[model samples]
Structure formats: structure tokens, C-alpha cells
Target: MPKITYIEHNGTEHVVEVPVGLTVMEGARDNNIPGIEADCGGACACSTCHVYIDPAWVEKLPAKEDMEEDMLDFAYQPDPARSRLTCQIKVTEDMEGLVVQMPEKQI
Candidate 1:
């Protein structure tokens, strides 16, 4: 299992253990993390799971695919360098202790 930390705008954080091979969104959804709605269910079609990668860990994540990039354009409060759809971020051993910040809103 990998540990993932989701932080809210108010500085609240939720840390959950996620099984390897699941998406970050799944972890959030399973743990009842407040910010990630994951409305599209990891299909890469919606921005409801939008989050901002911590600057230090941004480069550690794999590059976003074209479809994900396109979807991110619709994210609420998008940040050019850090915004990402949590559904696209698969949990992996390398991602142990991953930390992500939720946006103020998700459209």
C-alpha cells in the first residue's frame, strides 16, 4: 500500500493508505476525502477530481496525456504547472507518501 495525503485549502489534511495500482482519486474516494469528487470515475473525462501537485513532487509524476491535459483545461482554479486530474494519477510504490492539494473548487 502507498500512503497519500490530501490537503484542503483550509490546511486540513487526510492521509490514507491506498492499494498499489489504484488511482489517487480512488484513494481519496475510498477514504472519503472531502475535496475529490471523482465524478467521472477515473475515466479522464471530467475535472471533478482536480488537485494541485505540490511543487516539489510535480516533476516526480508522469507527464499528462493529451486527453488528461485537455480535461485539465476545464478544471476549476487550474494552475498551469501543478493542476492535475487525480484520476489520471495512478498510485505506485514510487508515489508512496504522495501529497496533493485540493483546489478551492471543482466544477
Candidate 2:
């Protein structure tokens, strides 16, 4: 399992241990962390799971695919350098201590 820290817009943090292979979106939902709506249930079709990866951990994640990049266009406040759909970030052992900050809104 890998531990992920989700920080809300207000600076509240929720640390959760997520099983490898699960998406970060799933981890947040399973942990009952707020601000990750995951309205599409892990599907890459929506931006409700938008989050900004901590700069320190950004390079560790795989590059976003075309679908993910397109969906990000719909995110509330997308940041090309940091915004990502949580559903596209799969958990891995090396991802322990990963941190992501939720956007102020998700649409």
C-alpha cells in the first residue's frame, strides 16, 4: 500500500493508505476525503476528480494521455503544469507520500 496525502483548498489534509493499482480518486473516495467528487466513478470522461499534484511528486507520475489532457480542459481551474485528473493517477509503492491539492471547485 502507498500513503497519499490529499489537501483540500482550505489546507485540510487527509492521509490515506491506498492499495497499489487503485486510482488516487478511489483512495480519496474510500477514505471519505472531501473535494474529490469523482462524479464519473474513475472514468476519464469527467473533471470532477481534478487535483494539483505537489510539485515534488509531479515528475513521478506518468504523462497524461490524450483523453486525460482533453478532459482537463473542462476542469474548474486547470493548471497545465500541475492539474491532473485523479482517476488517471494509479497508486504504486513508489508513490508513497504522494501529495495532491484539490482545486477550489470541480465542474
The candidate that wins on lDDT is 2
Q: Name model 1 segments beyond 4 Å from true.
A: none
TM-score of each: 0.96, 0.98
lDDT (Cα, tens digit) per residue for candidate 1, span 17-106:
999999999999988899888888889989999999999889999999999999998998799899999999888899987899999888
The true-versus-predicted C-alpha distance at residue 34 of model 1, in Å, is 0.4
Score candidate 1 by TM-score against the native. 0.96
Q: How do the residues 1-107 of candidate 2 rate in per-residue lDDT, one tens digit apiece?
A: 98999999999999989999999999999999999999989989899999999999888899999999999999998999999999999898999999999999889
Give all candidate RMSDs, comma-separated.
Answer: 0.7, 0.5
Could you tell me which residue pairs clash in candidate 2?
Answer: none
Best by TM-score: 2
Deviating ranges (above 4 Å) for candidate 2: none
Clashing pairs in 1: none
lDDT of 1 at 103: 90
